[model samples]
Target: MSIHHRIATAAAAAVAAVALVLVGAGPAVAGSPHFIKNATTASLDGTSLVVDFKEAGLESGSVETITVTAHLDATFSCVNGGNNVPSDPKKTTISDEFSNSDDFTAGKNGNVVGSLPLSPPAAASVLDCPKGQKATLISGTWSDISIEDETSGAFLAIPGSFSF
Candidate 1:
């Protein structure tokens, strides 16, 4: 091959290698959910209503399902419990406090798919939430929730939900 042809071939090969590296290092695909967030907020009014939450996010086609698990977290009480969040509300009795795990499936493009309810739980807590004078993500061991997406085979956990 001529010297010019040899130089052209070498340049093409270098470009191809650089392109491969760049693509490999780039961020995940557009459909890949950067994070799975459960914006749903749960609350209670003296054991009248049991709240629940479901993680929300854009899914990476890889994530077909996600598991929602609870954590051991807490909310602080206030001297003037008025306007207090469920963590430490003043007048009402907070009955159900549970710490358990649940699962959900991913929607199209990482959308939120399911909700894990607080009142009717898969597992019941031994302790009565309203009886206690504190905050602990309902009446259970899981103060926070965990979400494991099957697509990426990863876990994302959160405690609080959007009050919606």
Candidate 2:
């Protein structure tokens, strides 16, 4: 082949290699959910609600907080507390605190799964009922809420509806 043709072929190969590397090293897209396989699931067992969160985009071994808001249809009056109505009477918010595992690394493109048991004093005050009371969730809607990366001080809000 001519020297000119050989030089052109080498240049084309170099350009293609660089392009592939850029595509592979792309950062995680902003505003995209890091959670996979259903971000959250809440199961009501008797008077307690166990919420499991499966998410990503958080640093390993970091302390993270999970908040859940229950949306109700009307004002709920509980026997064990005061008026027991949310200022935003339509929704009641609850939070669970926990720490990520020492090896729980969900880099920019990974996932971390965690679970919290909402029981007794902590969960009771949220449900607005005394401990051991059969707290009925009532006809309402609940959400996964938010997840924060304590290590990086980054917060990601989990909307009620999301897929993949």
Candidate 3:
């Protein structure tokens, strides 16, 4: 074979080898699990706190469960005598965790999306007020919000907290 032909053949083989290596590595990299940027979000919907999150690079067709958790800080006011009487406002800090879960199947792109709706404890239920006094929620905050993958026991996202 001519020298020029031999050199051309060697260059083609090298390029093909590199291309094969990259092709083989693609799936391994794509199959790794990760959280999509800005895809996880939290907001207050009426009396419920809604959390939405997206995870990618999961096993396709696999069943996955995500759990959302947060700590609630609530403030309440108790009034009597139809606002004719004034008293100190009561504040309650609920350190206990409130959580919700959702189940989803990973799509063909190895992505899963889910939402969790968390409801805060009622002010009347958690507060003590004298007879004829009404308990009202003044304000509340859901802090330390986080989303976890229940199937893998890994944290997918932590979008912080929201207030209402």
Candidate 4:
């Protein structure tokens, strides 16, 4: 073949090879369906329960809304004259469910790290205590903590319950 013709043929072959490689790698590069990675954690930041998680296989720069849900079991003690009120039920247990949602943007690597905060119920009220007593929060536990992809309505795995 002539010099120019040989060069043109070589360039076309290179282009075709590159195209085939890209086509073969397309699905892998796109990655699997988005999912919440393991090792997700829940902890307390002051009175608010914070859930931290990492979502993998997301589309880069895409936005996702995630919701964190947990059931809170809190204990409060009724006090009168700076001491526990023995006559009244000294301890009261409160159980409730709470959830919070936040938006997270995937990074260039198609992964997102985000945190959502859920506020615990307020301290017990006077109605929870004897007439002359005040209520004080003693301790709290968050159980069945779960993370969900609100956009897809899929629940993700979490470590376990936490205490505060």
Candidate 5:
């Protein structure tokens, strides 16, 4: 072959090799989730907590939202006596019902867990709170995390703490 012809063939081969390597290096894509569930409740610490979920039937790129409720008011008292997590929030409107928030684009369809940070004002509301006491809303900051597929009613909540 002539000198010009040889150089042209080498350039084309190099480009093909680089493209193959890049495609193999990324994470695998998944299908949209079929089930999205999580849980939340009050923690004893009065300062922090833990939250997690299982992303089943999850797709590769769509965003998923989990809703964790942090209930408030005087009707709650973790140390003395408090109700379990609230069963009533009028109706899950993605706003008044969910007290805390987080976002995760599913990776391989599994649990996406994390620590939850919270303030008193972000505490669960029980219709009222006395001077020094607050509702049993996930204390130490806690598990008021909710995961919602909006179009679907698939979701969950749990309880935990962050007291340190």
Candidate 6:
């Protein structure tokens, strides 16, 4: 071929190669989730606590496992006083740890919904309110939350909290 024709052909080939690479990389990039969004506590009962969260930015299957440590506040305590007495506001603090990976399927905006069961002592601390008073979960601190990513093989730390 002529010199100009050869140069034009080379340039076109390079462009086409780059396009192919980008197209091939789309799936891998789309499968990785970078952050967790809409993470909220669905319910906090004496038995178990459930949290619902969705993956954001990228697609699902990036996070293989999510480990969470939660700090819970017990708002009321039953004092050893007589009947019809007001319950003391003596707050008790408790903690629990759990993990979930069910909702992390191969899709975008994946929802990871799961629960952690409380031990008997832990449940009693939360449910031991006196009569005429309701046992309450005042606040929850979700700390030391880590996610293991399938693509990167890295553990990412995420911290969050909520109040009732």
Query: Any residue pairs clashing in model 6, and if so which?
Result: none
Candidate models: Cα lDDT each: 0.44, 0.46, 0.77, 0.76, 0.44, 0.48
The lDDT of model 6 is 0.48
**Which candidate number would show the highest TM-score if scored against the true structure?**
4
Off by over 4 Å in 6: 1-26, 30-33, 36-51, 56-63, 75-103, 108-122, 125-164
Which of the two, 1 or 4, has more lDDT?
A: 4
TM-scores for all predictions: 0.33, 0.38, 0.69, 0.71, 0.37, 0.38
lDDT for position 98 in model 5:
26
Cα lDDT tens digits, model 4, 107-136, are 888777888888776666523766777777
Off by over 4 Å in 3: 1-30, 80-85, 88-91, 157-160
Candidate 1 displacement at residue 136 in angstroms: 18
Order of the predicted models by lDDT, top scorer first? 3, 4, 6, 2, 5, 1
How many backbone clashes can be found in candidate 4?
A: 0
lDDT of 1 by residue, 1-164 (tens): 99999999999999999999998995444444434344544454433223344444444443345444443323223222343445445432232334334444545544545544433322113223343333333332334554555555555555553221
Question: Which residue runs does candidate 4 get wrong by more than 4 Å?
Answer: 1-10, 16-30, 33-38, 46-48, 81-83, 90-92, 124-132, 152-154
The model with the greater TM-score, 4 or 6, is 4
Alpha-carbon RMSD to native, per candidate: 11.3, 10.4, 5.6, 3.7, 10.8, 7.4
Cα lDDT tens digits for candidate 2, 19-128: 99999896554343344436666565544445566666554444444443332231222332343433433334433332232224454444556665433233334555
Q: How many clashes in each candidate?
A: 25, 0, 0, 0, 45, 0
The true-structure Cα RMSD of candidate 4 reads: 3.7
For candidate 6, the 10 contiguous residues with the lowest summed lDDT are 111-120
| Over 4 Å off, model 2 | 1-5, 8-16, 19-31, 34-39, 56-64, 69-109, 122-164
